[model samples]
Target: MTESAFINITELTREFKNKTALEQITLSIQEGELFGLVGPDGAGKTTLLRILAGLLQITAGQVVAAGYDLNKEPEEIKPHIGYMAQEFSLYEKLSVVENLMFFADLYNVDVKEQEDRIQKLLSFAGLTEFKNRRAAHLSGGMQKKLALATTLLHEPPLLLLDEPTTGVDPISRREFWNILTDLHLNGTTIIVSTPYMDEADRCSRVGLMYQGELVICDSPVNIRNLLDGDLVKITTSDWQEAHTVLAPLAGVKEIQTYGEALHILVDSGKTRLPQLTRALKEHNLAVDEARTASPRMEEAFISLIRKMDQVN
Candidate 1:
């Protein structure tokens, strides 16, 4: 591992009974960097995070966090890292302020420093006005923020968040990301996992996990660049005929219908679009509109998964 890396995992593997959860995963997360783990459900993201937090034992390989071996020095690692699970895990009946105080006491924070930390966290989470509100009475987004505040109360160097914005509204998700950005700016190393591809773009680096294995690890731009060929969106009067005509085309690799439009990936560029249109016209398919479409991160993710499946 490089000196700058705060978390290092080498050939890490984990299993529950006869089922493997993580498979020979290796990665390095830099100090003060915001890294994201992107995967579908049952992709082993939570398993990896639990192993790094020392909450779960690894079946093989090694994990090092903040200069301590995860298996050997969990106590040493615990004080330096904070973990927030998918479920906020806040006490439902406790007010936001009380919840924060409870965790501060659990982390053994000094009484003198606790008040200032709690105040700052409340302000940062936009919960200052709701400090006296019971967690059970708060909205889903507010509850999530309160949970984040509790996790951050002890001022850990590293924060591990699992689907922090999963059920949050768009505005609340934006606010939550802003808080994370602020934490990163203050030199906190953050590792977050989400099933949403758009959320992965928020990280400095991303690891794409599938079926307990990391299939791709790179910056979002680099991952999108891995997608080859050109994509075209075709909208026509006769959708079925257009799809049938395009599916058997010479250069077309894939065709997927999205609502009223068909997204076609071809080996060539706009030149192929004209030929496609011409072919559709010959088949009595009334073309309404056809244009080139940019390859998005979601498309890249799907392509990567398909490629991995082919290899397996």
Candidate 2:
């Protein structure tokens, strides 16, 4: 482990009776970094987060979080990390402030400071107005904010959030991330698992998990650069026929359909642009737009997964 690594894992593996959830995974995260974990479902994102939160036992390997060895001192590590689950456990009958008070007592927040801390968190989470409302009456977004607020009452330095914004509305998701940004700026180390590529783009660094393995780990810029070819956006009158015509062409790596448009991954956009245009014309297909486009996180992720699938 590096001197500055706040979390480190080596040859980590987890298994159920019939399957391996994580396999030989190794990673290191520094203090105050916002690290995003992204992957398809059943890719072990939740298992990893659960392990970090001291909720699950590691079947193998070393994990050190917040200066405590998870294997040797799981209980000791619990107090220093704030963990939020995908389906957060909230007391349905409890009011917003009541829920916060419940968790404050559970986390053993200082008696004298609890009131001040709860008040601050209620405002920070935009729930001050709804403090007296029952948890069952809150909006989905409001409930998520309440869950996050409860997690923050103790103000742990590290947070393990499992898909915190998964089912939230776009506006609420944005608001939640803004709160996370403020916390990050205040020097908290956050590890969040999200399925949204745009959310992954906002992280300081991202780890792409696939079939229980960490396939790629890097800054968003670097991960996007991993796309082996350029992207050419082509819009056609009949995208169905255009797709068939472009499938067999040389230099074309992959063809992704987007309603009426097709994003073609080619060896070189300059070389394939005219070739694609000419071929479509020969097939009597009308082209409305054709241009080289930048590769985005979605395309890069799909391309990388395709390659991995092919190899496997």
Candidate 3:
């Protein structure tokens, strides 16, 4: 392990019955880094996180977290890590403050200092006023906030969040990410897993997992830059016909339609755009607009997946 790694997994594998939950996965997350594990459901994200949190035993390979061996010294690593599972785990019948107090006590927090930490967490999560409300009565967003507050009660140096923003409204998602950013700024290493592509872009580093395997791990900007071409957005009256016509065009690598616009990836400096316009016109499709645009994270992700599929 390097001097800077907060978490290190080398050839980690996990099996449930006869099924493989995680392959020989290896990754290194730096200190104070907000790292995102992005993949669809059943991609082994939850399994990997559980292993890192020492909640589940791994089938093979080594795992280290916060300078302690996950397999050999889970108790030593436990104090330095906080895990928030996919489901909100608070006691539904208990009030928000009561739940926080319960978890604080579990962590052996001093009674004198517990109130100050609880108050700060409540304020940070915007649940100050709802502190007395039962967990079951709060909205989904508020419940998520309370869960987060309880997780942070111990002030662990590493936070493992399993789809924290899933099922959250857009505004609430933004708020949740803002709170994560604040923690990262304070030197806490955050490892979050999500299926949302946009959320993956917000992390300091992103790992794209597919079928229990990590196919790519890099910064968001570097991932987008892997697509070697100028992205052209084409808007035509007949999207179906336009896509059909442009799909076979020379230098066209991929075509994705979003509403009325078709985002096409092509080799840089290719004159395929003019050819596409002419072809659409021949098909009686009105070429209302066509212009170059920057490639988004989704584009890069799709491209990487396609390439990986072809390789396998």
Candidate 4:
């Protein structure tokens, strides 16, 4: 293996009792890169992270993560990876420091190193003042941070996090990402799965998963440029009705909704802008506003998934 390729997956597939979670997934994550996995729910994001963390059994294919062959030596791989699940899996009854000590024990961290490590991690996660407080009494965001601190107790080179900031307040979510950014700057290879498009934009690279396969993986800038057409955004109370009216228009290629607004992909933005306005007027649907807008990651991702669905 080369020095940069910290995790290499080739034709990896995982199957359960009656379902296949991942199929033919081949990816290479370089050392110290922040990789984001973004997709709709049930897209096998969890399965891929579990496989890398030595938590799930792979039915076929090869995976070399953290300099250990996962198929042959899953236990050896554990020491080199720190995995944080989506839920708050730390002990609720224990104080913040206790949870860290427990995981430090599980990972067999050096006794002499435990106190210093725990003290730094508490301050690092902003849980220092709450160190004596029970984990169950911490806020949602604090609990998530505590879980992250426990994972870091092992001082693993690779971090595999699954939706770490989901369901948290926006401010707390921002705080968690700041911690991740610090880790990345310190040369820690982090692979995180998140449903938030904004979070995906912050990564060094991103992978989009669909239906058990990795559909696309690239830098966020390149992914935004992958949109084949320009976007014409329109706001209306009844976007569903507007979508039905304009979906079959000559210039409209794809229509996706952002809450009440619709992002319509078109062959030519200026030519289709007027056509869209006229069509809406003809249908007696009052559009709040219509203009050519730049495509974002959310639009590109939805477009790719739509294309994949069409191909299948």
Per-candidate total of colliding backbone pairs: 0, 0, 0, 0
Model 2 lDDT tens row, 1-312: 596699999899999889999999999999999999999999999999999999889999999999999999999988888999999589999999999999999899999999999999999999999999999999999999999999899999999999999889999999999999999999999999999999999999999999999999999999999988899999999999999999999999899888899999999999999999999999999999999998998888888888899998
For all predicted structures, in order, the TM-scores are 0.94, 0.96, 0.95, 0.96
Worst 10 residues of 2 by lDDT: 1-10
Question: Mind giving the per-residue lDDT tens digits that candidate 3 earns over 1-312?
Answer: 575687889999999997898999999989999999988789899999999888998789999888888889877777778889999888999999999999999888889999999999999999999999999999888888888888899999999999998898989999999999999899999999998888998999999888889988999999999899989899998898888888987889898778989999999635777877888888889988988888988888888888888899
Q: For each candidate, C-alpha RMSD in Å?
A: 1.8, 1.4, 1.7, 1.5
Q: Model 4, which residues run further than 4 Å from truth?
A: 1-4
lDDT of all predictions: 0.89, 0.94, 0.89, 0.93
Give the range where candidate 4 is weakest over 10 consecutive residues by summed lDDT. Answer: 1-10
lDDT of 4 by residue, 1-312 (tens): 354698899999999889899999999999999999999999999999999989988899999987898999988888888999988898889999898998999999999999999999999999999999999999999999999999899888999999999999999999999999999999999999999999999999999999999999999999999998799999875888899999999978899888899989999998999988888888888889899998999999999998998999
RMSD of 1: 1.8
lDDT: the better of candidates 1 and 2: 2
Clashes of 4: 0
TM-score of 2: 0.96
